[model samples]
Structures are given as C-alpha cells and as structure tokens.
Target: MQSQNELRNLLQRIDHKSYPAYKDTRGSYDFGNYVLSIDHVQGDPFAAPSKVSVHVRGGAAKFPADLYRMKCRRLAVCDYLLRQFGQELERVSFKAKGSGKSGLLAVSRPGQEVLERTACQMDEAKGDLVLRFEVGFPANGRTVNARELEKIFFTFLPECVSHSLFYKALDEKAVYRAADLAEDQQYIRDHLKEQGLVAFVADASILPRESGVSGRPMKDAVKFTAPESMKVSFALPHAGKIQGMGIKKGITLIVGGGYHGKSTLLKALELGVYNHIAGDGREYVITDDTAMKIRAEDGRSIKKVDISMFINDLPNGKDTSAFRTEDASGSTSQAANVVEAMEAGAETFLIDEDTSATNFMIRDELMQRVVNREDEPITPFIDRIRELYEQYGISTILVAGSSGSYFHVADCIVQMNRYKPQEITAFAKEEADRFPLPEVKPPKQAAPTFERAVRPDRAFKEDARMKLKTMGRDGISINRDTIDVRYVEQLADTEQLAALAYFLKYAEIHVFNGKRTLRESVSLLMQYVEEHGLAAVTESSYVPCGLAMPRAQEIFACINRYRRISL
Candidate 1:
C-alpha cells in the first residue's frame, strides 16, 4: 500500500556514486557526481516544468534491468508529483544506461494532440518511450535558469497520466496491490462483467520518428507491432476515431443502423491509407502488412478501361460515339473500379456497395449468376479479393447496409449500432460461433386431454377466405399459421433468406415450411396470381360470392385446423 510519494523516495534512495562539478561558459551544476542529471528543465528561464536528462557517469557504464527499473521509477515519480502538486514534468532522457543495451527513453510534452496518435514499435529491443516537446535552446552555451526548467517540467508533466505511469512502475516490480486502474486482465474482466465483453488495453507506447524512416525518405512498409492486445468496446462512435476490432486481415464489415458514423470511420481509414508514412500526421499502425483504398466509380472520369467483350454487349448508341463502352453501359463501372484497384497492386480494398449500379450488382439475373457460379461478376471480384489476401495476399474492408447479400460473404461483422462513448464490437464467425442465431422453438403444445371432438361441414369457410383475401390485398401473406410474405419481401434475395428464417424461428413468428414463415402467405399467392395474368384461374375456381375453390379450400383447411385446435 505504498503511495507514489513513498515509492519515489524509496527509488531515489538507491545507491549512486558521487562525482565533482565542472563550471561551463554559463552557470553549471555538479551533475557529473550523479548518475542522472537535470539539464534544461525549461526553454526560457521563466518557463515552468523542468526538463531533465539522465547522464550515465561514464557514458560507458551500463545499468540494464536497473536502468529499466530506474526509468519506471522516475516515470512513477513524475506522475505522482504532477498528480499531487499540480506541477508537470516536461521531459526525461536516458541513453544506453545499461552496458550493452541500445536505446533511449526520452519523454516530453509535444502537445495534447499527441495523445490521439497511436504508438507502435517493431523491435522491442530498440523500443523506448519518446516524448516530443517544443523548446528553445541558447544560441551558444548560455545557461538556462533552474526556476524556469523546474516550472516547465512541473507545468506539463501531468499530461503523462495517459501513459498509465504509476501502475506501470509497480509492474516493474512483482507486487500485487490494489491498483487504481487495474492491469489489462482485471480491466477486461470488469468490462466483461458490465457488458459481457472482455477488452484488453494492449500496448500503448510513444512512436519514435527516427525509427520508422529509411534514410531521408519514408519507407514503403509501414510496420508496427504492439506488445499486447488492446481491449476496445463494441458500441463507440466510429467517426474519425480508431476503434480497434483487433482483426488483422480478411473481409471486415462495419455495419450499423444509418447515421451511426460508418461512412465517417471509412473516411478516417481512407485518410490513413493515403498518409501511412512514418511521422505523418495521419499515420496509423497498419500491422496488416499492406493496405489500399477502394471506392465506387460514381464521379470518376475514366480515360480508358480494358475489358473483355464476350461477357457483355457493346454500347451501340450515341453515348458510345463519344466514348468507348466496356459493357454496353456505364452502369458496370464500379466493378471495373475494383478490378483496376486490384490490378494496381492493392493488398487491401475498401468498398462501399451502395454506390454500385443495381443492374450490375444486384439484378436478379446477375444475382442468379453469382449464386449459381454461372458467370461470376461481382462474386468473382469479391472471391479474388479474398484469394489475393489468402493466396496472393490481399484483404478487404467492405461497408454496406446491415441487410445485404454481403453478410453471406463477410468473414467478420462489425456492427455500429449507436454512437456514444463506447467502442464498436467486431464479431468474427470463425473465431466465434455466433453465426446463424439459434432457431425459435415452436409454441409449447398444451398438455393433451382425454376428450374427443367433431367439427361441422363447411365450418367458417367463407369468413376465413374473406379474411385471407383482405390480408393478401394489403401485402400480408400467411402460410401454415405463420407470417411469411412480409419478411420475404424484406429479403433482397434467397441468400438473405437464412437470416429471415432465423428471425422467424427465434423471434416467435409463425413458420409454414420447415422453417419458412410468412405473415400473409395465401394473400401473397393471390397477388402472384394477379401479377402473372392468372385472373382467369381465380374466376374459374370461384364457386359463388366471387370465391375461388382453391383459395376457399385453403381457407377451409386453415379455419378447420384453428377450430380443432381451439376445441
């Protein structure tokens, strides 16, 4: 139960050999006596918060684990001082404090904006916590005032709380105490208790500017490795914020109700894609090996497109007189855009399918082709995107409505239900078995009694037929005492039928077929009769009062069953 103040005092009491002071052009201190030195605490003599440097007594001596412990202890002291006294520590510096270790831990206050940047490291051996600060230096060897250094360090050191310094210092030692903010494991368990999810705060560190650059130019590979996995919520706002789903590759879907910030999140990702170089303001730790941007061809001005002629008709009208057509129309341009992005060496593709032309993407004929594998257009394009990620190496992030055929093909589903102070939850079917929601059980049958019942002839047939006709006209169709038509109409195609079936089974809706349920099945059948020019079938089958025999017979069966069940 040692307080941070006690911890700092204990850490500073560790052994240190003293040395002598050497006066310079400006005022100087006896830093040579100490293993660490406080150098230039602040830019100006009047600035608050001190900037300190740890100068190894002989530049050749090493401190290895002791240096690590010292760094952690110092961080804890700074955090404790800032929190307790409202004074900030501007920066800390250390280099090769250990005999053979290679690295420096330089902590500074760059700005509040630095907190938003995600820090990742590739080599733990070379990893160090870097802090960038804006400071002024003397033109020559002019001395910086001690008061100013102290003021600057005290003023800004509080910002380091985001680094979780106090607990990390305790982590340096093997001590299990009541932590104000629990370790990642405890934090995860707490979140699981509250929201049925366990999110870990992987590794949070500071990014080094020099480490990622190759020579003077930025390297093509934007590599980042985190020491641990970060736990993120599933219901947070996705706009311009990085909500880590912890997914590495393959198709990831960002789904949610409209106006939930899916598009905004995609835009943020787009910005990252274009500005992925190290030290860039919008750089992100893209550990996925490679990434690329994908967008529909809505307003694009294509100069030329190379496409095969066999799969489609050539434009024959005046529009073609001005430009060459790829598939008889400009509607299929979105597919062409994806193809081009792939050809351009995109390892990851981002697609928003709403902008894709209906004729090319979702037409019944085209859908059938995609479903049957007859002529894979969009399906082949999607399949190739996956194949490239798996075989040739490519990944895709596709954004579309929650209700679409894409769900069938998506490897991961990230639904952004509502915007708030929460994080988005991403579900991977392969990693978890939340797929195909459990089926709804039938209504519990009433315990049987020892009574025999009989029904009258033609009981309630006319009333049932009239009810079925009325429901059918209003777009409700019922079959087998279950709702079918309304849900079926909501479906885009048969592929999404499984989801609807899940709804029927679990949602307690009626099921007519093995699992198919329609609210107004008979009515839908009647409407189908009318649409298909089968009015004569209805007229010829009606015995009286404009009632068709087949329709009447179906109604009689349903009504009789209802009566028998009621009895």
Candidate 2:
C-alpha cells in the first residue's frame, strides 16, 4: 500500500486532468492508523459517487468486543456509526465547482428505525472494523479538483473515522443503552410463545405518534398500563423483571370509540416487529417477527392465488380457486392480500377497520336477512378468523371500533380508554350474546395452498439491463415497470425497499429456476444472505452501503407485483 503523502502527491499531479483520470487513484492508501481503499471509481462527477472504505485495526479503534458480541448489538452499533457518519458529512462545507451531485459526501442514510445493515461490519476474526461509504470526488466541470479532494480525504475523513470508530470519542453510555434495548427486544420476540403471548407492550410504553407520517412519539402521550387480567412479566437480560400486557396467542380484538387509542395501540403493535432506537418510545414493545399488517388494496394485481376460502360463487361463476385480476374490488383485494401474506409465512395478522373493506370484515344479521346466503359470494373474515387460529395456529390482532360481530370469535378483548387498555373479554361476550351474531356458512372451497410456481423469466437475468431504484418507502421501479407496495405495511424503511430490488435481481440470476416455488426461491435468497452477508447481493465491483435486511414476504411481494410474472 502507498503512503498517504504519496496519494496526496498523486492527486496534486492529476489536477486539471479529465474526470476519468480519477480512476488511477483506485488502490489502497496506508494512513498510519487506518487503511483507506478506493475500491471503485465513478466514470464522471455526474454519475453515482465512487466507492470508498476505511479499515481500522481493533487495537487502533479500541472498541470492546462486547459492544458487538451479539448480532442484534452489532447491528445497533453499525446503525449508530452510519448515523454519526451522516452527521459528519453534513458539516463539510467545501464546494468543488462541478455539475450534478458533484463534490458531495454521503453515507448510507438510515430511516427512523435502526436496522442491521451492510454499511459497517465487524470482522472479529481479523480484528478489523470496516466502514464502506460513497464519495462524489471533487471535479471542476470535467477536470479534477485535487485541492478539494485532498480536504475531503485527508482532513474530513480522518475526523469522521476518529469520532465514529473510537470508544472514547463516542457516548459509551448511549451505545450500550441502544445495544441493550435491541437485545431485550429480540429476547421478547424469541420467547413470545414460551410466555404464552403473541405481543407485548410495557407498562410505560408510548403508543401515540406525533402525526400520521412521523414515527416520533407524541408529546404528553399517555403511558400504557396493563389491566390486571392481561398483565404479564418477563425477566430480560438487560432490563430485568419488567411487566407488560401480554396479548394471548389467538384471536384478539382492540375495541373502543374513535380517538380512544384503539388504533394507536394497534399501530404500536404493528411496528413492534422492528427494534427501535434508544429513547424512540417503543423500544420495549415486541411482537412476533412474522407478524404482517393487512389492509384493503383496491387495485392490486393478483395472480393464481387461492382466495377461494374467503370468496366463491361469483354471479358469472368465475373461478376463485385460481384467481387472476388486473383490478380487484375492495373485498376481493383484501381476501387476496390475506392469502398472499399466508403464502409468505405470516404467523400473525394485524388489521385496522379504517383501512379494511367493510363487507369483507363483517356481515351483520340485518344484511343476512336482506340478502340470502346463497346470493352472497363473499365469506366475511368473522366466519374464518376462529378457523385461522384453531386449524392453522395463526393469530390475529384486530382493531375494531365499529363492529362488535367479532366479539363472538375473539379469545381476548382489550378495550382502550384514554390510551389505557383494560381486559373486557367477558363484558364483550355478554354484549355479543345480547345482540346475536349472524350465522354464516363456511365456504366450500378447499384449504388454500401456499406454494406457487414461478417460471424462469429472462427479464431478471444477468444480461438484462434491469434498472432497480426505490420510489420512496412504498414502491420500487424495476426496468420499465413499477412495483406498488403501498399496502405492504410491514416494509418499515426505504433501505429495505432498495435491498429488496437487488435481492429480486439476485434471485433471478442465482436462485430462481422453473421448478422452485416462490417461497422456496425466497428461502434460498435468505439463506445466501445468512451465509454471505448483504454485500453478496451486489454484482458490481463497489459494495453498496444502503442495504437493510428485508423479510421473505416483502421480497416475494415485490416479485409478485412485477408485471411479467408467469404463474
């Protein structure tokens, strides 16, 4: 490796050269304390930034092994470092005259939630910590700006590395606290069934957010309190012997008037699948990792899904067993969503009445009297919810403010009042008995199959020019088509969407064949990630820094939404 001064001299000599001349700097430079490697160079200043990495020996960085001993803790530290790097980049005020994204310094930007990412990795075996980031190298039009480049590499970078990597320079207490929170969150999720619970909310947990789009907690939000009937305690590794409301593993209903915190509590539970950062107000909240949030999507495409369990016997005798639709109604779309989630291995379903189709969720006795059972084609969720738990061992947590028909099937009922939850299963049962629920016939279709065969398509092949870009947090642009994931509520961050796009491409090239089911394909991709890390998905010479782990469900959801699927 060349010395840092040698790199500086090379940059000075290359000043005023064409931007392509920057490619000559692609090599390792020894900076005494750490080694900087320019792995890939951009074609021009207008293109995506060049890939850069820094490696510090364990003795130099002085980060304790315990800080990253556990996988959860390691991911937390990586996320923390990424955030620090972003802040440091913001402070650099240098402007090298150039066009489009020129002279910019950036790292993998994190969202509200902290997740395991590939931006930073700890190599315990090698005793080295590696940080991968991007740099828009300085350029004046098409020529190199060596002075500005020197400032970025020699001055700004070393400071960022010193501040973010060293133990003494960091807030040690905050780092340990974030790691501990993540550990406790994982512990709660891992032992949910052992504690006879599907979800948990600690006594002082904050349920209300500041607004619709904000993940930050609302100021003066009421602290959650568990009713005596539903209260349960856990002995966590870090925060020992904490008490919380343990939602039982079966049909659960959250019921109350509007603005009474019913949906607020449900929203908290939905987000509990992810481990939040320290002081995020929902750090202690935990739920099953396989939980999926389901809602009605009016225009989603469905391909060969067996939604026959929920809807059958159409007016024109359409085949519900192998349903295919370009534009589905509210009820059919909701039914398809549930079946698709099941195929993707969801163990718990979270639903809110506000976003759900009214007819699909319930059928009152009045409606039963007005319309004969044979005339109605849709089998409401109320009829199959118990069967979901009893037959398939699946659990559901539903928010119902307008319907009490669900009370008859719910195994546990929690009523929210002023953001406090109280167990009201018996009271709900009494009320349900007073107002009789409609007796509905079960659909005569066979049990839905989770497996669907995907034909090998050339569109995702290595030779294909697949353009994968994230369209915010809800959608992705793949080649010429866009995959809409607005209703896939569990996709918590944009990084996951970005990673999913690449994973789909990886699957098309490496995992997918004509014989394997979509689920099998996703499993293979996940197995690859587990063995090779997230960086393995990238086919380019430069390692991407903005990838977060995505669930198999979300991966297949993106694949299914692709317009070229041949089911």
Candidate with the greatest lDDT versus the true structure: 2
Number of backbone collisions per candidate: 59, 0
lDDT of 2 by residue, 378-407 (tens): 999999998988887889999998888889
The Cα error of candidate 2 at residue 402, in Å, is: 0.7
State the displacement of the C-alpha of residue 79, model 2, in Å, after optimal TM-score superposition: 1.6
User: What is the C-alpha local distance difference test score of each model?
Assistant: 0.31, 0.84
Error of 2 at 29 (Å): 1.6
RMSD of 1: 31.6
Badly placed stretches (over 4 Å) of model 1 are 1-243, 274-290, 298-304, 308-331, 363-391, 420-567
Off by over 4 Å in 2: 93-100, 124-127
Q: Write the per-residue lDDT of candidate 1 for residues 1-567, one digit (tens) a residue.
A: 223333233323421211011111112223222222233323332333233332222222221222223322223222222222222222332211211111122332211111111011011122232222222321112332223222222323333322332333233332221111112222233233244221211222112222421112224422222212323443322112233324445666667778664553454344232112223322332222123444333433332233221123233322211223323233444544444344344556655555445544333434454554333323324324444456655567766663354454566566644321122323344433344422222222221121222222232232323122223311222233332222111111221222222222211222122222122333444454435322222222211111111221222123222211221
Question: Listing every candidate in turn, what is its Cα RMSD in Å to the true structure after a full C-alpha superposition?
Answer: 31.6, 1.7
